[model samples]
Target: PGQVDFYARFSPSPLSMKQFLDFGSVNACEKTSFMFLRRELPVRLANIMKEISLLPDNLLRTPSVQLVQSWYIQSLQELLDFKDKSAEDAKTIYEFTDTVIRIRNRHNDVIPTMAQGVTEYKESFGVDPVTSQNVQYFLDRFYMSRISIRMLLNQHSLLFGGKGSPSYRKHIGSINPNCDVVEVIKDGYENARRLCDLYYVNSPELELEELNAVSPGQTIQVVYVPSHLYHMVFELFKNAMRAT
Candidate 1:
């Protein structure tokens, strides 16, 4: 009954990069952001849970898959419990921030967990192209939502002193108005190179001469989340290294 009621009231809103940047300040906008996340997270989690539930029985039975489902269920329940609380009071906001932090920490293993599940499924039943495509689609959406959820949570937590204070100028929560793309790429390459070297005897060096040209002097800056760009670049580098 509670689940049904909660879903009825809150539908997930379309969150875009522009919208996130626009509200990336530590002012009255934060309250609106907090309230939006407070309402939106549970609905997103519920949708993820529903999609996971619809996966094939064999896949669902995988231990990692089960664990992921349990995490989602637990997170959803926690958010639902806090659903009606007003974000108006400092105490309530602080408590909610704590809850967000807890939930964020709990989902840290989500990527590897889902990957393990896919490995287990493939090992047992072999790959069915149609089924694989469906699973891939689900995973893509799931991770995208996870990214958005974490961004929202981190933005709120940063604004509310969950971590060190958000940057006073040019930063709204995690979004950096002048994020340097080349610097992020270098960071990603270094990280990926470190792992590659550890796993393989010969790791290819990343050549970023072109990127470095415009990197200095903040010549190429975008209104974006640096960590998100780093994640994408890291994966690309990792894949390229593996192929090399």
Candidate 2:
């Protein structure tokens, strides 16, 4: 019941407007179709649980059956704890409040809705033959729910981070003139290389090529979020390094 409620509440909306940009080219057909699959799973699960909860109490009162109920409660509590930790961490990192708050608010909705349903499920059905038989099935759905949440959060992060990052860095640079753009990029690249080295301890040493599009007798200067750029480039480098 807890797993079912969690996935159902976190499921994708039918009217979701997610778009994929083709970073490599302008061809729409070449771009990947990225949409959260299994969005309707929650509704289906809610229905299944609704039916199962109607079973007789005699069938659900067994000692072994009660173990499943305890497991579901523990799982729900863990999920609630995770959401609380995320909220607290975001509060500690207020520099990116605007972007983080948006993600946090979405979580706030999901956490409560899932919590409410889990509470109701606990009250209605503690453990029964239907749930015991289907617990493994719903466990897989819970795993999928976590993965879906991660992908959704990543998409929102990239969007909000890009939107707010320029102003964020500018505000920082104004307070500290020593924050040089080229130097920052260089340091970011170095950090990424170190991370790659740590990850691939015995692999071939990875080399990153820095390219600049320069016109004759001109220098290029661009200002952006160093951390975000570092993450983007680091992911690319990590994949390339692994491919080798």
Task: Mark the regions of model 1 whose C-alpha exceeds 4 Å error after superposition.
Answer: 1-11, 26-30, 165-170, 203-205, 209-218
* Overall lDDT per candidate, in order of appearance: 0.79, 0.42
Per-residue CA lDDT of model 2 for 1-244, tens digit only, reads 6656655454344322223222212332201211121223234334334433453454335343344344334333333333323333544223332433343344434424433444455566676677655654554564445444434444434433444455544332112222344555566556666776788763445343445566443333443334445656667656666676
Candidate 1 residue pairs that clash: 24-172
Per-residue CA lDDT of model 1 for 124-198, tens digit only, reads 999878999999999898888788778877777666654654354456777888897878999999999999989
List clashing residue pairs in candidate 2.
8-42
By lDDT, who's the top model here?
1
* lDDT computed for candidate 2: 0.42
For candidate 1, the lDDT comes to 0.79
Q: What is the overall TM-score of model 1 with all chains considered together?
A: 0.84
TM-scores of all predicted structures: 0.84, 0.27
